[model samples]
Target: MIKSRRKLWLFVGLFFSVIILLTLLVAPSRNQLMSGSTFGVAPDGYAAWYEFMQERNAPIERWQKSFKTLQQNYSDNSITLLRVYGKSAQFAVSKTEREWVKKGNTLVNLAFQGRVTEAPFSTSHETDFGAVKIETTRRNTDSFKAILKDDFGAIIWQEKQSEGKIIYVTTPYLAANAYKLSPGNYDFLANLLESSGGNKILVDEYIHGYKDKETQEIEETSNVFAYLLNTTLLIILIQGLVIVLILIFVYNNTLEKKKI
Candidate 1:
């Protein structure tokens, strides 16, 4: 009777463990929650939404690690780089020296912030050109990639920034290659949406000052590994306790029956 009960619970645990292992093998392997280029649209009439990281009193290394962990699950290439301290960091992206150009009313900035820090920058200028088709001159880098579709016609013109970069296909939107699809070839879509604060963001939405902005309860990327480890330890501990309890119960029962 004692052995029978123990076997029942053990079977249940083994069955659930198998289910968990199987699910891990089949789920979409990535933390990226969104995908879609900000192409064919201008950042003029519409105000673009992005999570701004201010002076957050958080460890920068922790944030970088979190970002890296998320990137590892990617099955392909593509990602949005909002630019961190882009003025100096632009050097990692743009290929040419500093220059300027003018749009109808918007001054298109095409200057590199140089790669000293991780941040975004803008030069908003326009040169002697109107509607131009972009040609691939270089790749974004191991860390960045373009996300726009290869649909634009013949090449018309290209702008070289200090950073090794690629051009997104269309306009009227944040250059896709700069934000989502093509440049570095490491492109992925983000779906994190704004939730509470005046500027709220979800999973994929990269917040500007995430570390300093607020206390996050659920860090999906980091939490997964942590949870896996903790849960595994708990399982082992519980199993040991369970087995000890069972042995004691059996011993006690036998002694009681023998005595009776």
Candidate 2:
């Protein structure tokens, strides 16, 4: 009788475990959450633009790893896209990224703070695009700055280096899922990409907590267990304990009955 009860509990546990595993597998990955990648469908994500680029057969790739890793894999000719929000530290550019751009590649960085510590440009004007606002700047007098209509200065600006070019935008809403629908926002991005003159485009995903291949497996494993423990393990363990206690009580009562 005890053995049968144990088997039943084991089956129940396995069933729930399978269900949980399936749910997790079907759900969005942590890397996709709030990430501006093609896979991410979040409000702040750039899924729309990603798909649009795909449909147009534009050379766009989501770099779901460290900038160092991307630097190693992609050639210097690839155009790298990076968007920073809140604090610049959230998506800090390293020496690898700077060198990559310096080696004749284009780097488009859109920041809410309108600053890149490693490479700074001088501000000239500010502009509004419907609900979005942007501050524009240029590296030199010859550097490009997109003008909207005739008066408003569009947030887009460019700085030409000896080998490469650095384009900075004050706001990322131009490419975000919510604002990309606007014609002005869409046109601005189209023009920027055209002027960059690169066949390969790499959108940085490291800011969304994506790690390099070497550390990804370990971090994912640890993160999953930690998430389960924090969110569901307490209740699951309590329920399991109660089940075991009830089973013990029932088994004891059965033994007492048999003896009596």
Candidate 3:
């Protein structure tokens, strides 16, 4: 009985140890998306940019609400930076946001395709990062015609709507972790920010599926196994019952052996 009990405990300990090892090894590689919240450390995440801003003591805010919601609380002295990956079908900057931008607050929306409804402009070029080039647009109004391109001279143009600006880049890789390593790409981003002339910058995280504090909380709970254990009382109760049963059985068997 003693040997069987010891073996059972050994198996349980090994099971838990394996679980811990797998969690540590696998968790880091999961749920990471490009253009995710700047807080994430994934290769596609903007964590590097977040840390860079912090190091520079830049007055930056991560806006986790929808564009409409953010416009409701918009400030004229700040610059809004919105990055959209994949397709631009579902993302829309509300008229309120446009009105907010028209009030002299700069809004920079970076995406691969489509312009804000307020600015009806399109680019004609291939998406090539190997040879990046840029040019100023001929229809430039309020300097919105400025175009960024690859070395291949593909036009990545900028469009203007009132006082706000919309920049359409071929790829988001310029700000991504792997591509930001290039000195030219890094300088391009720095120049873009410097030109915005707003000390206060707000980055939109809502479009990346992290819409609010509640969503963030859910992500944290889902990622951590310790959180799961703490929140599930039934599992704890079952574990306690199993332990109690094992102890009771061992005690009763010992008592019976002594009588023999």
Highest lDDT scorer: 2
- Tens digit of per-residue lDDT, candidate 3, span 125-158: 3333233222223222233354554233333456
Better of 2 and 3 by TM-score: 2
Off by over 4 Å in 2: 1-37, 84-93, 115-154, 211-215, 218-260
What lDDT does model 3 reach? 0.55
Candidate ranking (TM-score, best to worst): 2, 3, 1
Runs in model 1 lying further than 4 Å from the true structure: 34-260
lDDT digits (tens) for residues 140-180 of candidate 1: 33222323222222111223233212332222223333332
In order of appearance, the predictions have TM-scores of 0.21, 0.54, 0.52
Task: Return the number of clashes found in candidate 1.
Answer: 69
* Cα deviation of 82, candidate 3, in Å: 2.8
What is the per-residue lDDT of model 2 for residues 1-260, given as tens digits with 9 covering 90 to 100?
Answer: 68757865775676577557756765556644565555567666777877877877777777777666666676646565655342223345566766777888887776653433322233222233233322233222222654331132335566666688777665555566765555446545755675577767767666665555865875677886765765556556655775666577667868876998
Backbone clash pairs for candidate 2 read: none
Give the residue spans of candidate 3 off by over 4 A: 1-36, 86-94, 114-144, 150-155, 212-260
